[model samples]
Target: MHQTPSRARSASHARPLPWRGLALAVGAAAALILAGQARAQDSGEVTKSHGYNFFGELKYPADYAHFDYVNPDAPKGGEIALAAQGTFDSLNPYSRKGRAAVLSSTIYESLMDGNAPADEYGSMYCVLCESLEYDEGKTYVIFHMRDDVTFSDGTPLTAHDVVFTHNLFLEQGLPSYAIAVKKRITNAEALDDYTVRFDFADDISRRSLIDQVGSTPVFSQKWFEETGARLDEPRLETSPGSGPYTIEDFEVNRRIVYARNPDYWGKDLPVNIGRHNFDRIRVEYFADETAAFEAFKAGEYTFREEGNSRLWATSYDFPAAQRGYVVKEELPDGAPPSNSGFVFNLGREALKDKRVREALALAYNFEWTNESLQYGLFDQRNSFIQGTPLEATGAPSAEEKAFMETLPVEVPDEVMNGEVRMAHTSDSARLNDRRNLRTAMKLLDEAGWTVGADGKRRNANGELLTIEIPVNSSGAAVLESVIETFVQNMQLMGVDAKMEKVDPSQYTNRERDRDYDILFDAYRVFLGVGTGLRQVFGSAEAEFSLFNPAGLASPLVDAIIDKALETSTQADQDTSLRVLDRALRNEFFIVPAWYKANHWVAYWDMYSHPEEIAPYDLGYLDYWWYDAEKAEQLRAAGALR
Candidate 1:
């Protein structure tokens, strides 16, 4: 479905957008026209913020509503040196979209901060609203807005704003987060200027918890109305917000400057209690990844948490890494990376045969991909709950067994059903090849495929077995190499496979329409675990056009996701989710690909942090910073010159 034009799903979050997103195109144009020679704050070299210097993650606002996740607890904040690659429009939090939408919120903020898996990782700490209580038998969740909270424009932040933004997003049907928000809220009413109450219709066990605490970010009711633009407009500027940083200067297709909110209302509130400690946070934009990376090396920006490993190995050797200031340390005990894999679009007719699908999964050499192209940089996620607290890792605790029994999810029936767990047989390629070939041969034989004279499998029409995989143009050259290996592996198994290198525009259109036979691309889901997995593998979700590869959703699997979403307890949800995942695994719904184990990144050693260089909880950008003195020193050392 063609989604709305909002710059982001929720102005507060940057759920990954389509590669080469239109929002990115706009942000780039905005960044270029806006650049000018840096001014020394119209004063001499500046230093220190009162008696405290801040560091760690900082904000780089794209607009009033969209902000990048640059942590706040870094070192002494100063003129922020950051870059962007797209337009910084659509600052309103409720209707923002894409990367710039992320930039906007880091400059601004909301009522609560929710970073991850809500079952435990998500906790709603009040930002503008300090105390929240569920009254009227938990039928209505009441929020007490902090009296001191005010928008950057000096208007009081009130309950009306929260209610209005909630309703606004609901009306817009934005992607990335619309369905997530729609599930919980029946009604959001502005009870009064300071107190707002939410009324719900379902027996939502965590109703107050998820809504008031989980993912919903409140916006300024007055500021939005005053701005007089639709929330998703690309021309969005003059965004009214009361964040730790206020928009000091903004150019449509250029850079944005945010001065520290001298009157940041929630500076002492619970969510803002010990964060947002920078004198300024800025976000600039560029056109391409190459431009942005080059600029970072030129000392124009400070950090990049990335996918480009070649550069990290080669680039950071800039003189900065030699000094103590430009420290580079590989973090220890970081959370496991979210699994990145190709989700089979089971909507097509030919892929309906689960046997053919399983055959494809056995063909991918994940070990080879990880070792050669990635230098063993990523981890292989064997389970659905990658990085989640209760993933089926190591072994189950007594607490886990007790937790599993109460929920409606399934425990793998490997022992009972005589099913081979993919995990067990996939430890090595030779073993996988033998096991996978056996499995593939059995499935294909059952599907009416006959063996030819040469011992190659053939369909009913006697054509050599073949499956077409589409590779898009943007990264087609690398994908061509990856697919070439895959084709060779398939050929080794007596299957014919060919790569269709097509324009990304054409490929993406076909993908959205579910028009390809076999495809290679990552279905990158954030928060690797949560309820409603049916959205990805459910039969009913199938009609909603969700990905149910092999079209193999039985009644049991569909019921599990439904129960998990409706259940009151996290344990209950986990049990159901585990069952759902087990069902998916048994069906072989996806050919698993590689995952990132580490966010291999580098800054010119000039980057500084308030906290020591550390990895963030989950994959959120909490362990990044910017340095002005070191940045200037790098500049003085002729890095930029």
Candidate 2:
């Protein structure tokens, strides 16, 4: 699933996008859909299934007890406290007006819930839906809603609310989503109080139609009308939802607590049996990581997901660790690494040239940064889909070249025949490598940015070649230091480069406004690419979509993405994705950075998890249970407050 975009190391509380891996399962209905009229005429009926998987077989059967990765008998009832960097003013996560609190979407539930395993790609089981009906042609889908579901306000959740929520998003949601949804779905009608149907548009690809409608977050229609809530406005008054958690209490910019609903409607459902174990999930806000780490050392929070390599390597020798009150470990992370780096804002005129972007990328030394500042704990990210089979490797195959030949935009020979692009390597012992500096200077000079008498680069118009990386005050100290070193290197190349530090609120607004020349942001990496790519790389949305931080709009990229989404087989998809990766790397929009293959986590000794964690997620907030006896021991030892 595509995670929400965020600054360096900032945790996003927003829910994952629903339509991530919703392609039709291999060999399940492929022939039925591919044969079209012939298959539909032979079998003139739709099938009702308890779950859906677009790419592979469902792991759990209809009558299965629970997921193998979860502890169905896990105990419940204790609080888990984590830290949030930066302040928030709004409780409404749907709007674009204000910064929403972390985990603000915990109170919301979608029509279907996804499986926990990364290997079980695109599998979704019914939650609010008892079963969904779709034909072999896949032109339409009918959701048979469960009658017993209720909102947190004790109101019935029906098909009408689903239709209402979809329509509301169409009118007031993010522009990219609204535009994409309108083109795919032709009509959404409530057939009855307990049944809803969505008809698809004939012009678009039907691969992700079922997933698009199924993942819509269902909200309380009555709550919206009665409370006069606007989905586009910043407001503290939240509409009621049907999820397992509710807003328990809050203090703006200080802390927010979400308590488990004792009377939640779907608590006992098979899909939810082993999840939502915490009685309370509290988030404490801090200005930066330094303060948050000190608070964690003092027992202010119970869990910490360490993102700073320096701290993870050198710190953790506090009294709590010596007393055996905290447990620190590195857990396996099988998911693809995030495509994070210094993204050049294409909206800026100075960065419109590819040569200039490549020059800037050459200036940042990832080798030195990884070894000197990050403790050699990370690997240089080379592709958008790094470490995955879909990642383009050596020279493209003959089939890949043949496929690129048909694209409207010309694929560069370097991309079609050459090895996959990799970040430039430098000496780990020095921040400024003379060879890379000379290359960057030559590239800049050739691009019309020549060094002036004052030893600063300027264009033919005499405008200084300035680059600014706006960062929030809450960014990790090690990361800030890395940026400072990069700025120093850029300065050595006769480019005017500096880090602009701002408060969290201003940083948020500036990022939204696309006010910086270069910004450090991470793009969500997808296991199986889908229509969600439109929001991230499509030319139509690149100008305004917040997800497209670099404002990258390229005709070649748009064409490659379209080709990738139109594939029907896994092999075809992989070929198209390899081509797409080649196309994006050729653009050089982001200067590649470093990523770790595991999750670094530390927590108080009072919590426990299942022996085996799912490959995709840690499930700390979902399945991990609290230990009452261990908590009492910690309290007795005066290790916790």
Candidate 3:
């Protein structure tokens, strides 16, 4: 089973913004400039190189030995156990049918690696490909595969495999991938045994398109041909992949272990030099986070990344911690805070009115939640791209205002005046101030939801204003407490708000079907606001897909996204993004939630990591390695029972 490489395409769009101010200066009339460059490709001045970066210059040149952040001499020969919640039935991660094993991606490698240092602004280095070719316009790209690249089973990888992977995704994978790829890729053809060419559509951003295609995992064409298996099927036993590790052992729905491939083809690739250090990586599954945490404390799992703030603050006082057997640390989470919140389904007639949405937002008491519930460990997230330059700050820039004016209604004056804030009660008041609820009541009344004798808000026709927030069963405990607090606040304003916990599968289905009143999910901000935007807030997605869970179908939003995608300069991109952020905020599509400033990680102190972690990611797979001597020392110190 040759697997597709893990790409940033899945998580990049969820978070949109350039971190290092690397938005390239494509010059005046950027599209025309790119077109001119495309025409110049006939002159043969275009450079074919080993790698390319998204931003300015590549940090590492063609002859670079290894990444600067890795420890080249680090030795790895021990196992590292990690905890995973819920169960997995299939090893095929590409399929939408069942949950895939946690280590499925380790067995696959992509053509180019986008796991560059976080500050690199989404650059990628060649992995399986020996070198790549592209013109200045990036209208097309050619990947020259390494001659020695082969699957774990010794089957050679070729251009046909890459072509087959792309075609396979188009034919049988998720509709989102198919639709997106079809829109951007004009043609993907195998030019030779080890050479493939990809012609891109001119309408999309060339840089984003190239990054996406380059990061796609190349699969073995021969294996699929021999097995006659569809790419979308949930297969328990997958074909061998061309990566660092192979599935060593597994138990269905219990655990899985991956062993490093001693004869791995690209073990010495510069991109992989200090990465994938674990000799064996084992993952154990539990029913929920509580069980997973218990397993971590019991030493069943070697590491845990704590997501529950309560557990982080209150737990860890056990014998392991008292005996200095466990280590707890807060690592900086350098990425911009996600715009997480309760999203309204605009498809519901009652939620369509802007005033209604605003009224519901006012009912949320974030300050109280942070102080009393989260122990002040979280900060409120205001912008979709909060903490980034693209976030709409004190006011829209002059360029942003100019772009906003093109729409029928630019943002409200309050948005232009200063930083947009959600309704908050002073912490000292402990949610004592009823002013926010009064304001909510006023807004609801103005929106035709009047309080009746029954103490429920109702419209003229006597339909009560009801909001049902359905949460996933796995997160029921954590979210239920938050929802209870919010529902109480909404009830004070005579709104019939309630919370319901459902199975993860049911919740996913309902979200996809748009069957709930409001949803709790975060939209990933796009790094390079390209075709990915269409899947998120685009009008077409609003109609056909679940990406736009809010059912937000606005011509204004569509235009703004298009403008952002077209802008090539940092200034232009920033302005268009600010305008888009302002517009989204003005709609109150998402009732803002809170985000923690750091990652809460706890381990048994038997692993070694690079001195500096990637600003955006923990880099567990890329840099961290098992420490055998440290493990033995811990055992001697009674850290391990």
Candidate 4:
């Protein structure tokens, strides 16, 4: 998953390509010569490239037409109504402040569009850029400006605008993006009126160079100067963008309406030929997902990607669903599974011991949860990169063993012997497995916790063993059940564990501040490795309060992640990733959770989509179109009222 600021953050909103990991061998001279020849053919003064792939070669040719996942002749006229989980206060997505609207990215266009095919991995196609140019070394990237591009305000897009946007993100964006740019990108310069070049630091990898440059969205320099708006503050005014849509109307914290740009410059581009098919995209924000579901059932929204497994299994028995006015579809998922579960905050002294953490993890009964709550629609996610070749399985290869030898700490024998220790206990029949409970109790006793006469375990200081879990409203239903079961098993082992369902905003703020004992969280691991991964397990990120939610800090883990990112060959990447996965699993910072294999979605009968969806995304915003005739038919039948 190659994350771009212009891309959406979740599956339910405007779809963005995952900022996946990259792997490719480089051949310098021949690559530079070919790029120069291609560019020379396009323009006399400079060479240009249409796109780049992180893997070996580009699948689509130089003169390729529209993407295969779209209907070229799809008509666009009607509107599509969608639902958002929480309230949105800001329109400026670059800032780390308020939650931006769901489809906010639709208004902005990037130098390259990251809508890639299944096999391409981290490939990015030219969108705002007519062509791209870079040496095989990947020290710098040159974007050949499309002369015909213009913002919604009718201002011409130029190299200066690109430079300005890059600087804004570097100075005042999310700490993750800011830190990445400051370290990887050296400078951005305008070569001419129609060309911009992004110079990369020598330490940057080939994959990181392309992803960072191509995914950057160019903002109008003139608009910012005139408005005098702070880039770090949340503003009501929509930033002028050159994408297919613009803010038609908006009511703060309620609903946002976007109208397609009649003067959109890139509509006919090969990358966007059949995309952005809706005339209007309206995103309605609700306080909670339950209210949003009820609104969806009442036809307040036209489409929904269901996240609740229980609702998908038994809740859709309404008149619209029974009458076939609404449709339900299950699409295959190709991306990696989420590592969501009860994560221990290592900042707490009580959870600092590996034995205690391991004992707590063993008490969670995922098998029972899958059978009762989820309808057996999920599988346990064991590794960080679940459902991928990068995942560590079976035993460590000779390469992985060699890498582990260099580390200061010894790799666990169970991991080295290819024995995977699942978080669940052995007994599938009982919620509180007595065998697993005894094991947990023995481990706790060894870790200096003894059961008191009151049946509560306590340390030498008489401090009870307690774990606090803070959860948001969206996860309340799913987590409440899991928490109840986990607490039951923990009580048998003389441990006190409780979960508090907090408001959405309170939960987000507490998470950002890193103020909790145990929290239900999920982290997505991509296919490739890079410095961006530091946010999850790196010691430096722990200090910055970024993605290291568990407060994990280990020299061995850092070294493994660094080695994986630094490796160039496919074989080397495989070895380093496995070693890292094995090392992290041994730590037991998070009690692994279950993940669904497919996307469960329901939509109104008034919409249509392309036959093939992008492997990494649903492509609803990009490929799905509103059928006005169908909408009228449903309206006449009083099914859509």
Candidate 5:
């Protein structure tokens, strides 16, 4: 399955302030003034900087079309390209799901961005909106846009664009659009050109507000009104946008060319002053990942970012590595790969019982699977969101302790009784699944689901336990095999469990529609904790129609989710999130899986990495310039590997 590389395209509107003091003068000036000269004269290669590096060949240049090297007037050019494994045609962030798609949407956007750190999973930074202001209760939020901000077309951006985008989230009836927008934002009114206020019927937080609002891409009022597009058919919608790069050219399943807008309004915004470095970004498409990789070896794309660990270790160093065209780079800061595991569809009817979920969690053997298919290339994880206040890190803060003690939310005996039952990524002391299975077995037995004569779990009604893992193989494949191994182990233990892989496109729909038992690798969440996990197991977000990926239902978990939303302070929010995490862990709702530290990447080295740690690869995109002379040197020496 040849795939097209993608980036996130948040459809929100935001603004940046005066950048005189931010030390962005050099970066901002470089992007605006010497962009062409920089691209034309870039040379030298340094492997490590802050925590991000890339050298993979671009397979799909059609969708991700580059015009910088060839012609600043022809199309925009980008340095990074992925050997996409499959054709996930959707590029719009609103419609896209997996990591590649989501990240690609960001690349194609001018709003929000994620940092590619030297040592972490990374966090998102705001681009368009200045700072989201949350009310004391967290229900209402105010977004203040910079007066000078303008769309890619050079039209001054206003609060109207922000309100318009949210309204579209409702009008288009985007799946998560309602959960993130409609439920809380009862009313949206632009105070003036620079300010927009959202009135929430209920309480929600501000940290979450910008993500919902600022993260969305803003459109030109003129373009939208002229197109008469209501987003009913996103495939056909071509509304104008205001970003560093505008769609100079785009073709479905072929290529997308973005040129740096000469008159880009927010070019010098405080948040985006140093980003969107490429003169243009060109993405070309291919049939499947295998062919795409072959093309990468042929220098068609950059190289490869093996999403599957087995392939990361095995597939590389093939005939291609013999040449100097490919090189495997180990991460100096953290593990070489990213987190991978199953996301139990809490929205499914089969996932309703907390014990059922815990019992299912025991079925997979992370240790065995790690040794078998993964070859110890990945780490396991119990928390849904990694590296955020929302993560269920052990040793609760003072506020969290009190919240857990008072809130009707019950912390399991494992959490409250002498032992803390903490979660660790790859604890040498204790294996990831070892502790998980113990809890799983205990939770199931306590829930009254007994092992049957046939060695399969049966409810009182005599129905055998079966888990339907919805799979399409869009991004990661580790979970599918993990689920299979788990099912086999469960059978040996007198339990009936099996892995069911389905179409990737239909998997989310089936899970979202509340139509599946257990969807293996349900989603690769977009942001760290910025994206509220309320819909997955949240009472309201548990519906198939809503944002509920996991169909878990519990009054206790729901209350904690609500309480978490009620606070506006980051410190208190962290405390609330911890309270919510411990409460859900006690319920045994989600069968925590594995976590990958970084994208296990192997690419042809060319471009120079940052001098220090670049906060994120995309965040510092503007700071990166291709070295033509060095690129030619590597090309001649075959040092690209």
Candidate 6:
């Protein structure tokens, strides 16, 4: 799932007076002039704040020392080696041309930093800017850039770079992003050497506009111009970034090393304290999960987030683990689980009908697969926003029904009067659930597909009911077993279903081109709703949006998302989201899969973290530190080289 970064901070009603010294009269005159200029910018009173949030007030004060989650005095040194499963040919993650290396974009920095705590939804604190200025109506926003900020190449990061980067993305970034941004922002201009302003469009909701602009990854204008690098193209050369890490070395399909910049401009910033602690981050690539796991056991990589249930349950008893050289831990995760599933390609003619889609979804036996193959480690996912307050549970309330009635599209009776729809259940002992297969067959027959003499279903046009599932090679070890069972069950229902295993590069291209009947991916669910929903579920970009694989374009879904965005209070937003969940469940576009509530992680025992991990993020790469003493102890014991 392409998770949308939430953008926000509480609006300040007024700007604070600047401190004065011996030149008090001069300072007073300057302050009055600034106030007069602010009044001329908008009809409502102008306000200046250090951050912005859409949902509620900011948690940290303007002059706060640092986030409570971080260890401000944590030491920073040593390397943390990790693993990647696929090959990467390009260093640019923003473009769609080639597979981008992991953590490629970490070299760049946004204008503001998003709040990491799970409780502070939609809050953002300033990073590049000293403060943000806007009016009560939020018609426009101005960022007061800090003069001390500089790119890795030591060039001053001025307002001109910010304006240039914004325009660069508008012209060359992904189509979905370009489309959404153009509609929300009217203009981005450099008002001065260290001040930038963005004017908002009057048509759309203004709540996410500040965040939309603030979260923009600012690139060095001078570097881009000097190197003549296009944001849309793939290349190995990287543009100078103002962030802490810089690419040190990389070999295609093998390894990429990122070194922390000793002269990082924001190293001493309050928001950055005790963060970006790794002096070096090394990523080793493997052909598949088996190889990756083997490498982890051999100490080729120091850390691994175990995603394979079988490995977590049965394969962690290697010599290093038994000897206490490795640590296998499950950390608490409070964020909503990812809505992963088998997504139907609605653009395909054979799968477009609602009945056909529903029939395909019923073929997967989640209970049997979870117990028989996955070691019963996951919970079957039912809602797009599963395990959250927004998840629709019982029958719709009177208010929810009334809200649905106002939508432009028709609401199904199941969503209006019945209980919330759930995933089909099956007997855990069987590979093929006869009950579900019978129902699937009946639904397909109703949808005009009949079983032929050859025992394969065919439509009126004599077209075979085919479902092709393309699996990425890197994930084949883990996903193929589950898909194999699903295909058998689907085949038993008279549908010609098969799995196509391909390498990472081919899988990336094929998914982008929508070249399969069914693909496994996730539907991103956000705590705070925003304009980003348009890219995921809106009808406008459904045809070509890379973020939306299902090609889901429904007037009802679009209407509910819009309603959620326009809501004023958190309560109203939750109601609208519940309505959305109900509507999406009724659509039956995705075959619900499974998820776990905690993070399964394994690492060498030389690392340490805060006593309490942040609720939202594991922060392994952010807050976790390398212990020199522990490393020496491990090496002396012949556990690490």
Top-scoring candidate (lDDT) = 2
The best candidate in terms of TM-score: 2
Candidate 2 residue-wise lDDT, 592-626, digit = tens = 89999987889999999887766667678877899
Q: For residues 495-610, could you state the per-residue lDDT of candidate 3 as single tens digits?
A: 89898888766775687678899888777554445566667777775765545678888777787877676676656766877777777776678888888878788888888887
> What is the alpha-carbon RMSD of candidate 1 to the true structure?
12.2
Judged by lDDT relative to the true structure, which candidate is superior, 2 or 4? Answer: 2
What are the per-residue Cα lDDT tens digits for candidate 5 across 1-641?
00011123221111011110011111222233211111111343221111110111111121222212121221223455443333445545454343122233332342343321112232223456554455333455566556777665567777887777667657664554464566555898889877787776643443354334444556666776887755533343445566666666656655555567777765554344334556655555565445666677777666354556776777777654676556675433212112234556654545666666656666666666677777786666655445543565656666667776766666655554333344423223333355655566666667666777665667678766666555555435555566666676556545555556555456545654656566543333322233345555556545542434455567777766666555444356556655655665565544566656653556665544444433222222344445456567666785454
Task: Rank the models by TM-score, top first.
Answer: 2, 6, 4, 3, 5, 1
Stretches off by above 4 angstroms in model 3 are 1-44, 54-56, 405-428, 431-433
How does residue 268 of candidate 5 score in lDDT? 51
Error of 4 at 12 (Å): 2.6
When sorted by lDDT, best at the front, the candidate numbers are 2, 6, 4, 3, 1, 5
Candidate 5 lDDT at 63 equals: 22
TM-scores of all candidate predictions against the true structure: 0.71, 0.95, 0.90, 0.91, 0.71, 0.93
Worst 10 residues of 4 by lDDT: 33-42
lDDT of 4 by residue, 556-635 (tens): 78878766766766678767877777778877889888888887889999988877666677777777888888889999
Candidate 2 segments exceeding 4 Å error? 1-45, 114-119
- Model 5 C-alpha lDDT versus the unseen true structure: 0.49
Alpha carbon lDDT of residue 600, candidate 4? 83
Q: At residue 69, give the lDDT of candidate 4.
A: 69
Deviation of model 1 at 293, angstroms: 4.2
lDDT of each: 0.50, 0.81, 0.73, 0.75, 0.49, 0.80
Q: Clashes in candidate 5: how many?
A: 90
Scanning candidate 2 in windows of ten residues, the lowest lDDT window is 32-41
List clash counts for every candidate, in order.
50, 3, 16, 11, 90, 5
